[model samples]
Target chain A: MDPDPTIAAIARWSGIAPPNEAARIGLADNAALITEIEAMRGTMGFEEEPSDFKAALRDCREPTP
Target chain B: MNAPVAVTDLASLSMTEAADAFATGEVAATALVEACLARIDAHDAVVNSVIRLDREAALEAAAAADAARAAGRPLGKLAGVPMMHKDMYYRAGRVSSCGSKIRRDFIPGVTATVLERLDAAGAIDMGTLNMAEFAQNPTGHNAHFGHCHNPWDPAYCTGGSSSGSGAGVAARFFYAALGSDTGGSIRLPATLCGVTGLKGTQTRVSRAGVMPLSFSCDNVGPLVRTARDAARFMAVTAGHDPRDPTSAREPVPDYEAALTGDIRGLRIAVCETFFLDGADAPVVAAFEAALDALRARGAVVTRISASSMRAINAYTAMVSRVEGAAIHANWMREHPGDYAIHLSARLFGGYAFPAHLYVEALSRRGPLLRQFVAEALTGHDIVATPTLKTRVPTLAETDIDADPANWSRFMAVSANTRPFNYLGLPTISIPCGFDDRGLPIGLQLAGRPFAEATVLKAADAFQRETGWHCKAPAL
Candidate 1:
């Protein structure tokens, strides 16, 4: 696959260069992870925020003995 | 009064045992410190576990502890026990190299809150231990500091990024050590080195004054010889610190008191899915035997399905990678050559992810954790797995720096332990059995979020029935 253009754009806009060919190849696993996360795009509700994880942990805790 | 335990045996005692001996005047703090120092002096050259050894300071502190005891003054919970933490935990005015050359001379102005708590409990600070540079890698390969060798066999990998904590504790250099876990840093080392390590629920312990690799995934915990030691260590360190506002405010329970050794009727689920997929035969045999041991203790074991693990693993990698890249952005731009080649490459990939994808990874954490708990843990009090899906690997085989072909084995080292990081549940790894190569295998026990006591209870009960944790490496 061609190097993901969006990654290059983000790296350029952020003032950091993209990984070299070897390093980019090393990221093949991460590329698969990105694809997996991308597959779940619409599953999350609009109101959901990262902080909800803390609440979820508390809510799911085993009842205090 | 009972006869005093031999000084040569002091280093072999568990953290709680050593502390209790000190409390009852069976052994002086000085003797315990001396015993640990002697062990390090004898074996650390082979293990390469210590980055620094505060020999004089530890001796002085032990003397002070003895004086306090002689004066009938109150002693802290861990009074007189020796510990060495991963170098990332800062002690004011001391250099915490964080296993990286870039920070070799960087000194912090404050001591880590966990260290302060450990001091209050009377644990001696022997020095800092080696780790993956910047805690970036899963295997214990540090370019600045030499690789931490497994005490069992010097040629094998110690597992990382909490390399020294695992190897040192297994080598009997100290009673316990602090290890930071993000993507199996603590548990992997614990598994590979054959000891007990606990990563409490996310934010269960304070991160103040500790190094940060990932804000969301980082957890501070202990690597020790036994589950009871882990329980006691957690009791002293697991609570909110005002300095770390992100730390959970959940009431810390009496973790030690929870080890009643009666695990009868406790439900355990073994996910016959992602955790066991591609598991080597020896690892599977060891893991099955571990489940049988737990079953003999009257614990119920059920094979269950967990479909969310793939997502959990993916999100975990995405979030930690993005956060780690952002954390190291300025450093990478300025001192790019200072980091190891493998580390730079890993962070380079981190810089490639889109911003929204990072957000999506974070945003989906709650939902995935909810799904996991519902599917795998709703009926089970604990979920069990092989801490490492394969038997221990030799350093030569997993050294990515020497050859990039080693990447798959290096990354696979943390496969069984990484998903739990994203789920943010309380998990512990204890020695189950050894592999065909005589390397140790670990049985992992993960419980509901914040249920550290239940997790500790089960692990302690298992340790009571098995001699795995007591089998020290022949250094």
Candidate 2:
């Protein structure tokens, strides 16, 4: 995970040429959030839809407003 | 019955009170508008809350409302009430800067459906309020519009991206302001500025023409002086809008009618774990006192463990960050320099999220939400917590761009409030007490999905028993 092209490289490919220093630090700081995302792996059941609309609206007592 | 309002009391009259006075012929709409404008003129320089002040137009609208009343023509529920919204809500042909330099001159061809509803209810649009650039930050620091200072004490942060909305309402600049929340924008600001804010169930209000940061989590609501004001505002603004396909088709209940102020048998759940972890002494003290007040009102409060909250908070950020990054991808490519450095840096992280991870996070949202509701809200009518875990920080202390060390402090501003955005539950923040530094503290009450009436009922009951919501900044 440490050896691949950095977030900076991926961003450059996506055409967002932010300052190199800020980009590196920003991506590094985001590692924590990514780790949290990684923890969610294998947690979802296939029947569970990903959309918040589906989740939020499910079993909501009100008929859709 | 609403109390009779005098012209002199217009400056501090709650939204519902002002509206009632306008309807009863006790005060003219012109007088209320003038009182609000006078307050803005006197105190706005320090608060820096308003982005624009539509003086002539507001007066013209108020005069029309008065003319309608004089002629005994039909009037909307909010006849003659004045309000401003976060700069993001679009009004056709009007410049909605959205608190960003890139959109400073960009005008939309269509109006936000919420604005049309407010207009139909006879709310006078005073102007736009300041916010975090692109509604990205939790702290109300806007690099584009000067940082909106807290009305209580200008040195402290007002908590944002709805900074101006909270501060404007606290300063009594206007009765209330519309604020959109993705990651605690409305509640954070409301708590910090000592006002009331509500984020209804996701898609509970139409998002059409309002700026979007995270498509999944964005919620449009209000920051006002009292919960009843929020109730009236919600009743007018909420409902299915065909213009926004995602808008809930559920019927919009009379939120005001639910505020009967008798919470004798209400059940409040207190997750005493993640929400209170590392909370400051003053915050905990205020929260405990608020709980005691509720118990005195006959609410049965129960403490329980919500160990899943840590995970809930973690994934909430992931979803918003990914969506925000996607929304600004094109602009980041074209006009990257136009964004504030810190905001750009935050958005830059969004680009790094893998599509698979984003989908995983999104997919898990449903299961995780069910887990939370089942665990936290089974027999509970409302879950209460401090809106923010710490005392309000100074603007300088939370300026992440100025010093990256401030990142933790800046992030904590929304820690307790963001989970509801993910859960998509109806939630509200109301002033309960003040901290050591005298900044206001908020008691957040989150209800079940689409249970806004229950949320407002609890909040309005609290207001009836306490005078916190009536307190305003000396400024």
Q: Evaluated with lDDT, which candidate comes out highest?
A: 1
- Candidate 2: where is the Cα deviation over 4 Å? A1-4, A20-23, A37-52, A60-65
**Fold similarity of candidate 2's chain A to the true chain A, as a TM-score:** 0.48
Q: What docking tier does model 1 reach?
A: acceptable
Please report, in order, the local distance difference test score of every candidate based on alpha carbons.
0.89, 0.88
Chain A TM-score of each model, in the order shown? 0.48, 0.48
Residue A8 in model 1: lDDT: 62
- Model 1 chain B: lowest-lDDT 10 consecutive positions: B1-10
Q: After superposition, how far is residue B120 of candidate 2 from its true place, in Å?
A: 0.6
